[model samples]
Target: HVVDELALLSANIVEVVHDRLSSNVRAGTTGVTLSLETEDQKHMDKLIQHLKEKSIDFKVLT
Candidate 1:
């Protein structure tokens, strides 16, 4: 059940990111970079792992 919850959470995060990017584009913001950060690296690790398990590609800039 944890995995399922993670999957849903990850999906929601992706959607929010997508919406932000879309809004930026509509506002003529180009060459914008998006970054995700966590105060605790462990949470970032878990999120990255969940994204990878679902075949999503992401880069950690830290």
Candidate 2:
């Protein structure tokens, strides 16, 4: 549910370089990755804010 909420929060805000990287991932998978790619610093800032607000653990590599 958190992932879905995150997806919604980031909707239309950033460029998705790739979606669903792994084809073998099954439905209802608990662990998945959400990657956002963009040249704008705002996108990354917003994402970090969202993650903090949600109290979700995250790592950022620039």
Candidate 3:
């Protein structure tokens, strides 16, 4: 459901990856992470706004 919502977002998303940590126990065992990519500032803004509206935790990488 979340992945579908993300894919349907009206932003210039270049890609979307679902990642999980895998440490010694399992690097990404903590939880799944949504890694989104955009091509422009406007797209980034839209993505951020979407995350905010959904009350999702996110951090900018660049």
Which candidate has the top score in lDDT? 3
Off by over 4 Å in 2: 11-34
**lDDT against the true structure, each candidate:** 0.52, 0.59, 0.61
What tens-digit string does per-residue lDDT give for candidate 3 at 1-62? Answer: 55555666744345555445445235634444445666668877887788788887556665
Cα lDDT tens digits, model 2, 1-62, are: 55575666653334333334466555554434455564478866876788788888656755
Per-candidate TM equals 0.43, 0.48, 0.51
Cα deviation at 43, candidate 2, in Å, is 1.5
Give a tens-digit lDDT track for model 1, residues 1-62: 43464556553232223343564355654333345444466777777787688775446555
Q: What is the lDDT of candidate 2?
A: 0.59
Best by TM-score: 3
Which residue pairs clash in candidate 2? Answer: none
Global lDDT of model 3: 0.61
Residue 32 of model 3, lDDT score: 47
Deviation of model 2 at 28, angstroms: 17
As a whole number from 0 to 100, the lDDT of residue 32 in candidate 1 is 30
User: Residue 15 CA error for candidate 2 (Å)?
Assistant: 12
- The TM-score measured for candidate 2 stands at 0.48
The residue pairs that clash in candidate 1, if any, are: none
